[model samples]
Target: MSLLFVSASRTCRSSFSRQHILLSTSRFQSTQINPEIHQTQNQQTKADYPSSSSSNSSRRYRFYFLSIAAGALIGGAYTFRQSRKYEGLMPEYITNSEQLQRKAMEARPMPPPVTKHITFDEGPRVNFPFKLTLYQYVTCPFCCKVRAYLNYNRIPYDIVEVNSVMRSETKWSIYKKVPILVIENEEIQLNDSSMIISAIESYLRMPTKRFENISKLYQSVVEKDEKGKLSFNYPNKYFLVEPLTNERVDPTKQVQTEKTKDDARDNDATTTTKNVNNQSSPWFFTKFFSKSKSEHKEGLVNIGSGTVTDNETKSITSYNKSSEQYKLERKWREWVDTKFVHTLSPNIYCTLNQSLNTFRWFSQAGDWEQIFPWYQRWIIVYVGAVVMRGVAGRLRKKYNLNDNVRISLYECANEWVKAVGNKNFLGGSQPNLADLNVYGILTAIQGCEAFQDLMSNTKIQPWFERMKHSVEPHFADNRLRATT
Candidate 1:
């Protein structure tokens, strides 16, 4: 199990146990002789026997040397072929200990805060009053959404680009996903794109309160699977619960709670009563919640959808028929999440040409230049391209896409454009959550071949351009940042 090799300029030193060493007076061994050949020579004995013996021995030695040489050549060829096959298929990072230590030594301290704010079309001037750090992968769509949301809201923050392979930047967090958020004082860590956005929005709404405590609003539900692995799940991950107050709860919640208790008590006797009600009329029971004694509420306190109404039963019945604008926004947002987002990676990595084009774009547009040294940049470009090419193929199959993935991408673009239908955005005059979500996902692959092709072949260009112009004013000024 243990091996040590030592080599000098022209010779190798090898040691074997004394039992393994073979000392012989003659070059021939009984095991090495061919029985048939030996018998044939024995039959022709006693005519210059010593000279014949020497000639046979020389031929045997030559064949033994030739066999060894052939094996060496075969093994060398095999190793070279395998090595070339995997030449540039995985990313290579800077592993030099000296370089890492040097960078650490060269790092500077954080500068003092500024009172400047970013101006955007959404509302009044938005300000950054807390320390915020975002850990993300530059090319990821989910990360792109968080970035776009922060930019549009004009909340300034620092971006920490995570190494996709090592992820050394996020080592301190228990949850290993990006874009992770480390908020004020570095004690609060927020995970999941949806949860991060909700938490940030809540924090912005109430700037004076401690955002670090917002984690308690969304309860962490951990479940174990058959394999005995623990999984963390957050219910209503997108919902924000404000601090408890009486006015925040719906009045109808009290009656619903009492009715629910009575129903449970009468369950054994009421089986036929429910059947009688069903027999009397065609109806369905709808789930609606009322104001509760608990301090926390499910969603934004001011939002109508999250609150309990006066006529809770009727309200539940008419929920689907309520607001047309709300329905449309929800539909499109769902489409963006389910349909439009899936088209991106498949189209970008559709072919070998597109794959290289994407990785090359990433090399320029991403944080590679700032994070990686010169030589490592080349490794990312070449290796990332090969890796992405294989990923694109697998994604295509996973999404059950067409052979020409570009067609699916184009169709989705056209669907979105048609839905906009002469309006500036899906929300009519102003862009809504759905518009931002779609635009953010697309902006991630902005300059890549797939985006260019989609713009040219579909009607999404005008809307995309509008989105870019709309968010143009909100970009924060560039500044040096410290990594955590």
Candidate 2:
């Protein structure tokens, strides 16, 4: 029994040893296979990841390069557009520069030319009795009338020829217009022949010389107090003399009745005076005070009797006075300038021709027939007179002159002619302001042909014949010599 049990124990030990060996072999095989699997898995993971960060960085770089290229194209286009705009707008800059350069290259210098001098021989000092310098043109007819008047009265004067086309070196040079008279060295530029003559008479204190009949009539109509206080009567007989003479067989009877009616016409006269005065403000206190105090304190004081205190009050008052005077003066000047001048122009033209012809004949040494061929001279004169008359008519229409103003001007001119009637000038029968004034208008009229025909209707023709006889001797070319 003991031997069998010992054998069994040995057999069991052998069996356990074999099982341990088998387990060891299996562990070794498992370890080798696991190493191979792990390597394969790592490779697969690497393939799936695919280097994503590197790919994104490469795409961003490509985008940046593309953006820079597009921006460069846009900037180039913009610069080209700006260049084109500047070139189109300022073309002169290019054109002018070239022109200036060409002009500068072609420039040259020049010198002034020399001229000869003329000398005048002095003549004897004939004590010229006139105080006025009669500036006249040869072609003016009014100048002839003035000359006639002066010569008729045997007045002595210094005649200054003013050729409109010829310029003078004298300090007081006359305008292009003829008949500018200088009285006592003072220029009396008369636009109207009648006004000029009238002004001369006024200056010489002979207002009633032109129209003898009118002067006498006016004097007779003048109302005088027992003490010799002078006043005027309305609807005066003198004013109606022309109408009465035209209509009546005996004008003396009408004149007497008209003179007797003076007392009854007082109311009418007063009303007319008031109406005329109302047309414009009177030259009273208001005109003197209306100005700014700072500018005209003395003027205000003269107007207001020294009542103003504040600077503001004085200024206001002075301004009012100034405005009033300006209005009055402006109105008066306008009437004289337009109305008076236009009316007398026609009548003056007629008188001028007569005077010129008279003077020419009177002064000429040769027979009147030999002095000047009438046809040649008259034709030239006639054409010039016509154009002048047309111009005058057009001017009247354009300026809207009134007939009444013209009539008054005519009356004024008639008065002047009578005042200096037979006198050589305004200054006691010598060439004076009247001569210059009349000459200017006559010059303008004589420049045309139509005006010559108009003068034939008036007493101007005979007057001109007389004047020609008086002035012909002093002239070298009698036809060309100025009447004055």
Candidate 3:
């Protein structure tokens, strides 16, 4: 099935130039956060993927304990979350038919993103500022998180599907993870789904700053395990890089900003100019980033003067353009990585038949079938199904998930819904990073029995539908690939 799609997609493929790559409503090639987050062969990027485990039990327990604490804080925070009651914004290009088609998608969500042979002459919805390439597995939740962020923002990008079995497509790097985004011009390689989203998001918020400089702020802490294997911990994975006003804005670009201001009036349209919002309030940015988990307290903004304010007071009153919202967004984004994402795999692959069906679905969606030899495809489908079934079993025990699995999934959705409260999204009004993280993670399992159950059983359906309309509008094919 994948072979047929890939073969047909080739006829519609457009080639690219060497200097840059583009992507984003959108990220894939997805999940990495803590080096330990890779415990599940179902490694989730806030969104997660299937995994085969060699990780120690202690680490898993520790991670979940932290996750629980974070989840609790989020549940309480939303009760008084002073956010807006957004009716929700529509993507610039959505059609009435696409909105209606989403109803059917609740029954059967879109398959993992892959380009099918569809005719088109026009380019992608947006042209990204930097040239980027995402090397990914179509089924990975981590990649989906990145894609969710990018595509919703309408950031256009080129993607290369990595065979989960061989991963020859990612041979150029030392890090062999799915969702490795390479910023071609700077030669910066971004690994870990949370880091990728935060980096890109930070860049988007402060476009004038050199990205290489921005990336340096998100340094990783590598530690050798008992057996000498390296585990990476990006303590700031969930935090956005604050757009500090230390750097001066380039004044010369006002002409360009003005020239394109009218063009960028559409809320979600791809913009050629620097984001105008970033320009308006650089000094007011409160550098509230966490350097280590120990010091990773949220709620207070200590900026240039290093003065702290009561988080409760700050939440109620405005401090320049900064809001307690960023912290709130980060907390839930972290939850998706630690607590929420782990629930997906057990639910999706609870039974042998479900596992087989999932692998079959994956085989049909991405270019994996076309990319792999026939024997390889057969092994991936049959062998992968058996392996994931085992992985799911172990994860259930490791995560202490509910026996029914669907209950666990529902609880996870409810947890997020509770955080969102009456707001349109966790970020409110517009979908925030947390909102994108959850949506991207779930998008991976769409069209499956688990997804159908998630929609039917949970209140998440309305928010999910709203997110779907926002991300998969009619102007862009949400099949999620730029012509290579």
**What global local distance difference test value does model 2 have?**
0.35
lDDT of 1 at 102: 28
RMSD (Å) of each candidate, 1 decimal: 15.5, 36.1, 29.9
| C-alpha TM-score for every candidate | 0.58, 0.25, 0.60
Residue-wise C-alpha lDDT for candidate 1, range 94-175, written one tens digit per residue: 2212222223223412331211223344442334456667778778888888877777666666777776765666555535
Give residue 185's lDDT in candidate 3 (0 to 100). 64
lDDT of 2 by residue, 1-484 (tens): 3223333434544466533543443354346446665455346435643557879999999999999999999987876665554343234423333222223223311110101111113221222223444555444455554554444333344445442332231223312344544333322223233334433332222112123322222221223333323232222211112221333222221111111112112222332223322121111222122111111234221111112222323222333343443343333333333443455444333344643443343323222233234653454345444554555455555655444333444454454445445644333322333333343334344433333543543333333333344433342222222221
Clashes of each: 2, 68, 35
Q: Compose the digit string of candidate 3's lDDT tens values, residues 407-461.
A: 9999999988998999887765677778899999998998578999889988999
Q: Which predicted model would earn the best TM-score? A: 3
Residue 342 lDDT in candidate 1: 93
Off by over 4 Å in 2: 1-128, 140-148, 169-178, 183-448, 455-484
Task: Identify the runs in model 3 with alpha carbons over 4 angstroms from their true place.
Answer: 1-128, 226-228, 243-316, 320-322, 474-484
Worst 10 residues of 3 by lDDT: 255-264
TM match of model 1 to true structure = 0.58
Poorest 10 consecutive residues of model 1 by lDDT? 1-10
| Model 2 TM-score on a 0 to 1 scale | 0.25
